[model samples]
Target: MAGRRALKAVLIDLSGTLHIEDTAVPGAQDALNRLRQASVAVKFVTNTTKESKQNLLERLQHLNFNLHEKEIFTSLSAARSLLEQKQLRPLLLVEDSALEDFNGIDTLEPNSVVVGLAPDHFNYQTLNRAFRLILDGAPLIAIHKARYYKQKDGLALGPGPFVTGLEYATDCKATVVGKPEKSFFTQALTDVGCSPSEAVMIGDDARDDVGGAQNAGMLGILVKTGKYREGDENKINPPPHLTCDSFPDAVEHILQNLL
Candidate 1:
């Protein structure tokens, strides 16, 4: 706390911090409004690979969040940027619904293996192709390495295990482009025109949102919502700057204390 800088912008995790699945976190709208009233820059950062950015925006709008596409940064967005820059054609192992984000990309030759949480596409044939591609020198690009995520039913496996399995089989490590990865956080912070020390990251996932932000020199606030499990905060290497009950409470904390 002694070395912490003043909070100027906030990078919020979407799935757990603001909502889980399709439902908005209780009081999330009000908390967001408070941030707007506080006049701090805000960005919504997410590792959710289940839907394309446009679909995600629609879902958020349905949940009553007033966010612009520019303010929303996804791991997929980061992956897309990298892919386009490298001019790598992806052998996509992503959800069909999420394919729209990579819509314009050329995938005819399948130069790289872009893996996300595509449950339906995790069969032997599809994975075998990705595995062979990686073994044949194509890079494995993971959107994120989340072990698991919260769903409406309960906790469910995420893409981390699958990504690692492929890594072990192919003896190739994945280039992660999502949370817990500094690029994702830094890029979002930079887009908001704030240095890492001047911004804060708020989310439910201790490892990804909180730990990742902390590692990147931003203050991290762990919210007890979404995929949060008890003792998660204690497990992080450098613990979150604060832990709160919900997004609104985190908003209150930032306004009253950090600002």
Candidate 2:
């Protein structure tokens, strides 16, 4: 900590660190408020492809989080940017709710396959169609290959396995555009005008959030809530700067120590 840059921003993970499903982590809202009051820039980052940004915003608001749409960034946003950059018509295998994020993209004659966490769209017919397209030279775009996420019921499958299946069968590697990707962290940090060394990432996923940010040159805090399992801090090389029990604890560390 001797030579670290002064903290100027915080990139927070959405689902596990702040909330799980419809329930906000205990005192998370207040914790966020405290951070805001400190005058540091704050941004929300997530790989949730289950719903559109608008829908996700509504859910967060319903849970009493005070945030704006522009302050939130999702993996869907990154995938859309990639789609536009490549100018490829994608066969989006994402949830109907998430399709709203890709509304303007051409999907009629798909030249690419974009996969997310869409249980309803993971059927044999849909996958077969995507498989055929990939076989025909369509690029496979994976929004994020997360293994599992925490829900009210417990851990559930994420889109990683499905994306890997497509990759294995098609013999084509997927272009991932989400967490743990340096580009994703850079995009979020750029928007807030903060350098990675001057920011911190607080999240529950050890690999995607903490390790990812650390890889991008920021400090990371691993919280025990959300999808965190036992000994997750040890799963990654160069463990988190700190591990807290919840969002509030992370915030406390930031406010007391980092500031």
Most accurate candidate by lDDT: 2
lDDT of 1 by residue, 137-233 (tens): 9999999999999889898889999999999998889999999999889998776787899999999999989999999989999999999999999
Candidate 2 lDDT over residue span 53-128, tens digit each? 8998899999999999999899999999999999999999999899999988988888999999999999999999
TM-score of each: 0.97, 0.98
Regions of candidate 2 where Cα sits further than 4 Å from its true position = none
Give the Cα error of residue 67 in candidate 1, in Å.
1.4
> CA lDDT of each candidate?
0.91, 0.93
Q: How many residue pairs clash in each candidate?
A: 0, 0
